[model samples]
Target: MTLTFAEAGEQDIPDLTRVMTRAFDDESRTYRGLDKGGPEGYDNGDFFRQWMLGYDETTGYTILLDGEVVGGLIVWIIPGGHNHLGAIFVDPAVQDRGIGTQAWQFVERTYPGAKSWRLETPAWSLKNHAFYERKCGFTKIDETDSPDGVMFVYRKIIHPD
Candidate 1:
């Protein structure tokens, strides 16, 4: 499947919410160690809509597949260092299909001067950790707790010339 990256605007919030809800639903379940149906609930798109709308545009990027939003990345440039990938998400159904990797590659190419790119994933998400380490070239620099109680942190340096 072909994936396309785009700069999302206010109009795309509905689709973004749909994809994020599905992706985060599973994430919340896994972090809580609960079955598909559990007390630890997940946030819907409204939550992300509010949060993302508040972010400055220069650092935010979104990806679409076949003209539909399937993923997004929120980044920020820190004063003394490289940009941080604050959040990246792919639609649950479309994950493991290289959409995320391509999106990251897009970011790297878009910001070549960045000394490093940092992001965090759930400590228990072995799949994600391995993907980042082996495929994305990220390293484990530290660990921290999620507000919901999960723990892990990782970083990767996007090579510079």
Candidate 2:
């Protein structure tokens, strides 16, 4: 399966937001019995536009499989190669196809300067916990409470040869 990560444009916001909502809502229903869940402003794409694409040190992209848009990703590059994965998600309709793993490999290749990476998933997202810890090779470092929910912090340190 081929994958592409194109830098997001203003026009992509609406669809990306839809993908985000769908991905999050799926997990919420499975894990929490709720119909809605995600980072703030995802309901209307405001978070994607204002923070994911607009903030300093942040870069957002649209994940394309073959030629169709499937998801979105955001990254933050800070000084000292201490980077952060702001978010990454594939549409629920096409999930479990290894797209997320492929996208993560693409992310690592894209950010060759990164010496470490960090991200957070909601405490209740068991699938996310496994994906990050088992598939992505990140270790749970801590947990913190946010307005959205309790979040588990995960980190991976890249060792150079």
Candidate 3:
């Protein structure tokens, strides 16, 4: 039951890709009624590897459960406290157990200077919508039609007290 975040590296690409693929596939199967989904290279290590080590303006972490890679998260830390949450995916087998929430908390704590966090998700992903809006306090700022489907953009603002 121990959960941790480690700086991701090239060695983690395989595990991260596998977990990301599983999460995407689960979403497709459950929500989209499709056999598979996710953007290009979603299931491949090439995409996962890009974020694993050092990608432009991005900081990535591998979510570990009992020292095993179970998920991955990436954030684009733009200047001026305006940042973007690129992605966060956990193994479908371990979904809904607060791991994703913990990972999010980690982001906030690790970057106290962040004034806002923005991200986009597919409109059909009700599970993701709940997690970001309900659990993480993100507000839907915009919704746009994309080639894939309707896309929802969310933002969580931090007011310095």
CA lDDT, candidate 2, residue 142: 98
Q: List the residue pairs that clash in candidate 1.
A: none
lDDT of 1 by residue, 46-141 (tens): 545545566563355668889778878777776555668767788778888888889888888877778887887766666778778887888899
- Badly placed stretches (over 4 Å) of model 3 are 50-54
Worst 10 residues of 1 by lDDT: 35-44
lDDT (Cα, tens digit) per residue for candidate 2, span 1-161: 67788988788899898899999989999999998877779889888877786778998889998878899889999888999999999998899998898889988999988999999999999999999988889999999999978999999998542
Sorted by lDDT (best first), the order is: 3, 2, 1
Question: For model 2, what is the error of residue 100's alpha carbon versus the real structure, in angstroms, after optimal superposition?
Answer: 0.3
Cα lDDT of candidate 1 equals 0.70
Highest-scoring model, TM-score? 2
RMSD to truth, every model: 3.4, 1.5, 1.7
Ordered by TM-score, highest first, the candidates read: 2, 3, 1
Better of 1 and 2 by lDDT: 2
> Per-candidate TM vs. native?
0.81, 0.95, 0.94
Tens digits of per-residue lDDT, candidate 3, 1-161, equal: 99999878777788888999999999999998998999667898877656544467887899999999899998999888889998999999998899999999999999999999999999999999999999999999999998888999999998542
**lDDT score, residue 104, model 1?**
82
